[model samples]
Target: MEKRYASIVFRHLTADRLAIRYPGLRSVPFVLATPMHGRMVITAANALAAAEGVIQGMVVADAKVCLPKLVVMNEPPGLAQRLLRALGLWCIRYTPVVAVDPPDGLLLDISGCAHLWGGERSYLKEIVTRLRGKGYDTRMAIAGTIGTAWAVARFGKASPIIANGTEVEALRPLPPAALRLDPDTADRLIRLGLRSVGSFMDMPPAVLRRRFGGGLPARLRQALGQEAEYIAPLRPAPPYDERLPCLDPIRTAAGIELAIGRLLDTLCARLAGEGKGLRKAVLRCHRVDGKTVQVTINTSRPSASVPHLLRLFQLQLPRIEPALGIELFVLEAPTVEDTAPVQEALWAGNPGLEDTALAELLDRLKSRSGTRAIRRYLPAEHHWPERSIKEATTIAERPATAWTTDKPRPARLLATPEPVEVTAPIPDYPPMLFRYKGEVHLIAKADGPERIEREWWMESGEHRDYYCVEDQHGKRYWLFRSGHYREGEPQHWFLHGFFA
Candidate 1:
């Protein structure tokens, strides 16, 4: 089979939309500012800005003076990564093997898949059309090798430029930069009157190797398809996936639930076959009206049992409002784990208590309340009572061993720290009386002051002396006074937490 691949490169990807969207700013100067070494670094400049003598790595302050109307926007690294990932997913419609080529590009190995969408030309056109529909300006090129495709996508025109057999003739007219040579190499080639790829190709292989070193010759040959270039296709992630393409669209909740049950079975079977279990599964209902509704369920532990998966799905069934009828159902496992097979005890009838069952109940509670309303407590590496407890999403996997046996920890922790007004004869002694939550509480009994020194490195630095005190009302409170008596300022008292 003829190996076919595409290199889709988005031009000026780092530059923000202010340059492209604003008609008034189209001809005007604009620069994308990136912070480097405590100063704003100009990363990209438009043609008009360049004409005015602004270059990359120039200070933003100077660029502003050069062009008064120059618009500046902070370059977001996170947004750029998201755009690249979304584009990579969009390319999946063309070929299953899509690898993200960082910063702003994607490599797709469409090999035996091109015929499904007609030929290479049709596939490329469709890919461009879909991208354009989604408001992405893209440049695509298909070639015999990755190097050729990369060069052509950057330097070659929008026209389909295929390098079948006459690779040299095809690349001859292109500049030396088309071979992706370094700036110094390209400049040297231009100085030597070897400006075009054709000129470089005419030179003896041994002389080129001697002049440019071994890499240049190899790169040139690879670009020309004289040397075989191997492409490492991105292996698709193992999917706890189940799909149902209904001949008749499903409108009712019952119908949707029935389809969901079938999908759960298939998904469970696949997970079992792979010796894996899903922690979370997302049911994407592809509506006839083009919109998709996603219902997600999180399990406490890795599980592939049908009953457990169905129960979780049942909790979310009412939430699925099938507006125009769902044409297709796709259940995809976003998170999964390797679940060890349970060995049932000979005497025991059932396999203990299923964590999935508990997870389903929690999921129901989460749906009724808010997802944020449900949380799990995780132990933190701190002796301070307020900083010791951390809240995490119940869906998130936690370590098996969360607490350390060596540390002294309180049995109960308050969700929010209470405030206490204390009057002590000295900083060393515990408070005799204190006001908490606007109520007076007399400290009948008290414990030692556990001094915790301030972490100087952290922004929130505090030196606290904690005391476990029991009030006359029979409630125990953890109180602390910040700073020492020797320090100039008066000690500030705070009820850090509560004790069970």
Candidate 2:
């Protein structure tokens, strides 16, 4: 099969992105500026600014004189390159062989994949439509080679899609800059009456090399398809992806169910063979109408159970639209983990290291009421009571450090302790009575003055002397006296938690 490539260029990528974020800048004259040579200079300008005679490399003060009401803002660091990289990653959904074209462009090896979107025309339209929807000003071109695609995207007519074996014709009328030549070289060509690519491309190799540098001829041959050029495309992230192509397009709900089942089975088998499991997955259906429908599922633990995953998918299957008919099913587990094999015991079966029932219950609860409905906490090795525990991702993970046995902890912990007025002898005695929240409570029994020092590494604060005391009603309370007691100062008391 013949190779086909597509290139996308964002003409004013940074300025356009800024306009999208700040919509008012789209119509108003605005330039992204940075300090250069002790003067604020224009790094990039929006379409509105450019139309008002403002351009890059112009000093901001001079630019303001050109458009008196111009708005100048600092350009985000590496703005163009970052946007290009992000867009390159997004293009992976179309083709896996996508490469970054530096500051403002991307090269895609569409190859045989274009037919899936109904042809190169529809494929190009889809890409452009999505980018325009994202509020970017894009110019795109598709052709037989990357060089041809790159040249046409920047220099050819708007939205050009040239056919295979026509690169020479497509590149002939373009300026010398279209061959990726520097300004000095292109100016030299223009001075010699060699304005277009065709005018100087046919020149003798030695003459061209002597007149310009060796780079100009090499780039010209690359664009003309005379020399083979290889692109080190960005390899798509590895996915535990399983795909199923139907022999005939199926439109019925039952057929869709069966396709999902087959994909789940295949995916589960593969995951099991690899000794891995999925935590998050997406089911993508490629409908015959050139549209895609997707359903996502998340598990509380790394799971390979086909039935459990199918149940989760069934809950979201009604949301899929089978417009004409579905031709392909793709199940991708974007998140996976190493799952140890279960060793069955002689008397009973084992569900790996943790209880599977609890995991299943959590998954079901999360699927119904959302992930926040269920949560488990693990003990952290922090001396501060409030920072001693953290949310646990899975039940199988054990705490690295044991809970502190030196001090008796409360059953219920409060985010911040409430202030309590206590009547006690200063310095070394427990509180005899305390007024908490509007009620006075008499201490029937009490145990301890456990001294806990403040964690100076995190923050500087007062040390605490904690005491577990029972009220007249037998309800136990955890109280703390803050700071060291001075001879003439009264220490502040606080209610930190409750003991069971």
Candidate 3:
């Protein structure tokens, strides 16, 4: 597709901003000045002030002589760039690719976006009208390339929209400064009788480079579309993303749901075609009141199912507060993974981790309750009880080692063991009674004191002698004693887990 760009030049950015903040200053002649070399010098002049003999870089005292009533206000450092940045962000409603051209300009990549607003004429008209309504004096132009657009917006007096293949014609009438050359290079070109771009545009590259250095020739190529020029957007577009712009504000839940459904359908179709699925997706809502609210959903497995993902997002709809109304909806899938096609079974059977229904159910449950509400563990290749299990990374991940069923294991295992006081008849005997959490339980039936040694390579730690004890109430507990009894040191007992 052919690329198109738009440029906006603020005629009186600094003076216009001051007038915006103080409406009383709109009809008055004023100039924004700053301290320079120990003397206050004019940095910007409004239209009224410029009509007089007042101009930028003139001393405040000198400007006052031209217009005695001229209002001179202090120009804060970097204020113009700051205002341009904020204005660029607000322009995102028009195009997603908005870049701030420093000092007093903005560039927008409106390649295919203009058609949405009816046409390039209507699109540019809407933006310029809106900015002018907000008290900013702006000149806008659109062209097939950024260089030509920028040059025409600032210098050309013809039409705002430049046709494709006419970049050289459009740039020929403009001055050499329109190519964004440094002040010194532009002055050199002017002194050498190259007043307009057309004068030296067709000159030999080697001659231009030898006379004026490489900057002039490089910028010339860019403006003529011979070389590519790219802009650094304020917000980079995400890889897997979809956008929906509403004609009117969407205040009702049904409107939000409709927007989300449309976005998901388009996004899932793209993902399915690429044999990829999204694991995490975010829905960002741009509101009319200049606020953004978002909802995020994550799946246990990569999924391209629109219905399943839509249901998951529906559970989080209440969390979004549509104050005033939402104007734009953006859906982004930041995490995506390649998915393999699964064969459908003719008859109903156990699908286990491969069950799409189960995965969808888990995703819904997590969205409703919380991410930490559910977890899956797999057997690990280790002898230590603490190291015997590991959390599964993916839903379909398989364990490398099989679970040992020869010994009795607890249904609920504690992450860390807690100390407990116990009374035993002998050093190797089971606990007759134990006190845990200040509750004394008398042991009714007790099993053997099974010894499990700690893995020395991992760390040097005392081995545990585990025991399965049943209290008076038939509640079973797993208890362990650290190391063998010594002559002076006391034995430490801990309650490790419990059985159902």
Candidate 4:
């Protein structure tokens, strides 16, 4: 099959992305600018801003002079490249061969996949329509060659998929820039009356090479499909995936279990050989009637234990309907982590709560209560009590620094501290009595005024003086006062949390 390529040009990718987040800007004139020297220079502009005479590289001041109501935003660095990369990754759903053309375009090798989406026209239409629905202004073109597709998408009078062997004719009317030439060379060509590609395309290769260097000829050949242009396609992840196609459709629980066992056997063997394990795996069952049913399992640790993983997926088996019988089964481990080899006991040993067993238990808990229900926390070295503990992404991650345990901490910590009214005998002394949650409590005992300074790097004017106090009812509470007291100024207090 001839290699067919598609190019998607995002007319104003940066501005459109910003407009989606702030929908009011979609219909209004706005420009994303960068501070060049002392002046704001337009980096990108919306359709409305472009219509109002604001173009990229123009000074914001000049643009404002022309359109006084133009809204200007300081463009965030890498916003364009990041959004472009995300869009390129999103295109992988259509074709595995997707490459990002930096700043504002994506190249997709739709060679053998056009038939799946009807044809080249239908495929291009579906892609463009979906992107427009997501608030992106997109123009696309499909052709037998990558260069032709790129040129047609960008500079063609009207975007059309060029037929095979007609690239030279189709590219003749476009300017020399469509051939991807250097600005100076293109300007020289224009000055010499060789403005359109056809003016100099048929000239002697040696003559063009002598005037414009080798780049111009190479590009022209690439666009004409005379030279192979190799585009490095982005590799899709989930390198650890296994599929099982049943000769006979399976509907019974036993058959599904058997199929799952086979998949797990293959997947685990592969992971074990690679010395890596899965943190998350999803099982997709394609039904005979063209429906899909899926179940997912997650392990707290990277584990390649087959029985343990099979059990985790088993707990989720009931969730899969398989309404019309499953015809194909695909198990994909999208999330994986490298795990160290398990050390075996030299002699007789307990082997109690080992890696495999612990992983199985965590997986079971996750299956029953859902993934978010289970959480792991580790100590972080910090003087601030709240910052002393942090959530651990995985149980295997160890603390790099020692944890601060010099001071006593509350048994229960509030998500956010609540305000409380307090009465104190002295400005520096702990509170004598406090009113909290519409109830008054007499402070029978007090422990601390552990002052924690604010991290000025993050934010200023944020400090707290914490105190652990026991009330007359024997309920202990962690309290804090914001800032120091002034002789005539009012004081601020808050009930942070409770102690056991």
Candidate 5:
């Protein structure tokens, strides 16, 4: 695709901001001054002040002299860049690639974005109109290159949207300063009777470099599309993303669902073709009021199934509020995984953990409850009960080692064991009865004084002598005694786990 870029110049960024905050300043002449070289100098002058012969860079005392009634306010440090960054972030709904052009400008990579708003004319108008509504005086231009767009937005007066391949013609009439040259270089060019870019358009690179330094030639080449100029966007664009522009703003839940279905269909098709599936997907709804509403969905396993993923998103649709209406929908898969091919089933029945249906069910359960609510555990290569199993990263993940069934482990194990009061006849024998949570449980049947030593490499800790004991009411309990039992010392007993 042919690349296109846009530049927005805030002619009176600070002054306009001040006017917006203090509405009365809009009607009066004012200037924002900051201390420079031990003296207060005018950093910005409102349009009214400019009309009265007061301008930026003029000494505050001189500016006051130009208009005795001029209101002077101290300029907040870094206000210009701060304001530009905020405005650039707001412009993200227009294009994902928005770069802050410091002081008073922003750059947008609107190559394929303009078509969403009808065309370049409508796109530029929509942006300019919105900014104007917010009380900013902005001038914007779109061209085939960033250099050309920036030059035209600041200097050219003909038209805002420069046609592709006509960058040379559009830039020729603009002044040499439009090429973003240093003031000294521009002044030297003007002194040499080269007032416009056209005057030096045909000059050799070596000659221009010798006279004006290398910056001028590079800028010239960039403007003419000879050199690549990439914008450092405020946020990096996602690799797997799809955009759906609605000609009419979407308002109803049905409309939103339909949009999600369409987006999923498109995204899933691409993923399926590439043998990949999205693990996490986010849907961003850009409202007409310049606000964004988003809903995110995650999968238990990588999935390319449109209906299943759509169903997962359906659970999150109530979170989206289409305040005025949604102008665009962007589906971004920030995390995707390669999906392995699965064999067709000979008969219709559950395929256990490897089943896609089972994965979908888990995804739905997680979407309704939470990511943490659903978990899968696999046996780890460890002897300690706490370290025997590890949480599976994915539902399809295989265990490195087989589960040890030689030992009869409890169905449920507490993360940390609770202390229990036990009465045992001897150190090697199981407890006769245990008081747990202030309740006495008489041991009806008992087995084991299984000794589990702590893994020395992990940490230094006392070995546990575990016992599987049953209460009088037939409830089973797993109890453990800490350390070697001493003749005089009190033994530490803990109610570790329960078995079903």
Candidate 6:
């Protein structure tokens, strides 16, 4: 394959007036700031300030003095990151392999994709035009290597340059600063009588290496296209996906199922060829009018077997109503795992068992009752009965041990704390009689004055004296009395948990 690459550069990106348009701050001398001591410190200067002779690193106060019209907006790291990520995702429309060059830039390996967009120049124009249409000031360059592309995009002539083997000649007229060298290095290169890339290229390799270390020569080679560069294309995450654009929209359930079956066969074949399996799948049915209906399924294990996957899909197919006829069908797997060998049971029986059936049942329940509604209880690191249990997403397999006999825990736990009327002999004694849930229950049997200290570091902290009391009906309740006897306030008792 031929070597081809493109670097999309958004220059003075932090200072771009278009970007400053956010929050309606335009023509205002603004600087991007990184947080320091609860305040923002200027890092990059806007063009307006540069025209006014104000430079970066000037304190917000001093910058204001220089340009009274200065509009200093606190740096938004998150907004900048989101913009970069959006750009990166947009690049996927051109090539699946797009790497983010943060703070504002993208590196795209458009090797075999340029032809699809009608060649490199047209593709470059399309990208720049589209971005400009979206209110972004973008400049792009296409070259053999990343270094050369970066150099040209940052320092080449006003227009986007597409150089093939003439990268050195193409780059020679540009200034040495185009190489993205450190400020110190660029100053030294200038001191050494090298102003442009041409001056640096004229120097002997050995002399450049001796003076600038190993990096200078590598950069030189990269710019000259003498050294090869490889791009790790971001492959579309696996467990193959396929989409079918239907000419005649299908509305009936049977028609939808048939279309899904065809897509599943293609997806399964691709997965089998790649030696991978799908752990989860999503089917998006785009309607003719505009809406989208999505149905998804997750499996206990990775399985690309067509029959098994189709069966799972079949169970979910009825839920998707093609209201206005489905125009497109897209199958995608968001989660995938390796199809590892299953260890055969010592008894040599089929893998289908009660646990497997139960896992599927739970999955079905989760699908109908909402994934968040069904959960498993896990023990938390706390001695307080109410704080000891935590709810987590139910996993396919249960832990080896469900109950722990190592420590005594309440058999029942309340959903929420209930207030209890208590009268105890002392702060250390268990409550004698407690009115709970609108009923006065005399403590027929009781144990414990378990002292659980408040987690003082936590915002919601409470100091309580806990007790386990068995009522006349044989039901047990875990109650806690807040505050010590010496504390002036009357003790507030609460029933925190229960026992079977």
Most accurate candidate by lDDT? 5
Off by over 4 Å in 3: 11-86, 238-240, 270-276, 334-339, 342-350, 425-428, 451-463, 472-474
- Give the better candidate number (2 or 3) by TM-score: 3
- Using TM-score, give the best candidate's number: 5
lDDT of 3 by residue, 328-361 (tens): 9999999999987765464235568777788888
Model 5 pairs whose backbones collide: none
What local distance difference test score does each model get? Answer: 0.74, 0.84, 0.91, 0.86, 0.92, 0.73
Candidate 1 contains a number of clashing pairs equal to 0
- All predictions: root-mean-square deviation over Cα? 9.8, 8.1, 3.8, 12.0, 2.9, 9.1
Model 6: per-residue Cα lDDT over 419-451, one tens digit each:
878877766788779897678888888887778
TM-score of every candidate relative to the true structure: 0.53, 0.62, 0.84, 0.55, 0.89, 0.58
Best-to-worst order by lDDT is 5, 3, 4, 2, 1, 6
The Cα error of candidate 6 at residue 342, in Å, is: 14
Model 1: per-residue Cα lDDT over 1-500, one tens digit each: 76666888765554534444555656667777899999998876666677788888899988888778777777765766776776676555456578887656788887877776678888889887866554455788887777777777877754555756655666777788878787888888899888788887878889999998787788888887778876554546344566686877899988998998999888888888988988888888877665678888876678888886787788788889889798788788989999877764642343333443455566667656666777778887766655666786445557454677553345666665566778787659999989877889998998868888765665466688888889998888788787777746766888767777
As for model 3, its CA RMSD to the true structure in angstroms is 3.8
lDDT score, candidate 6, position 210:
90
Clashes of each: 0, 0, 0, 0, 0, 0
Supply the global lDDT for candidate 5.
0.92
The ten-residue window of minimal lDDT in model 4 covers 346-355
Give lDDT for model 3: 0.91
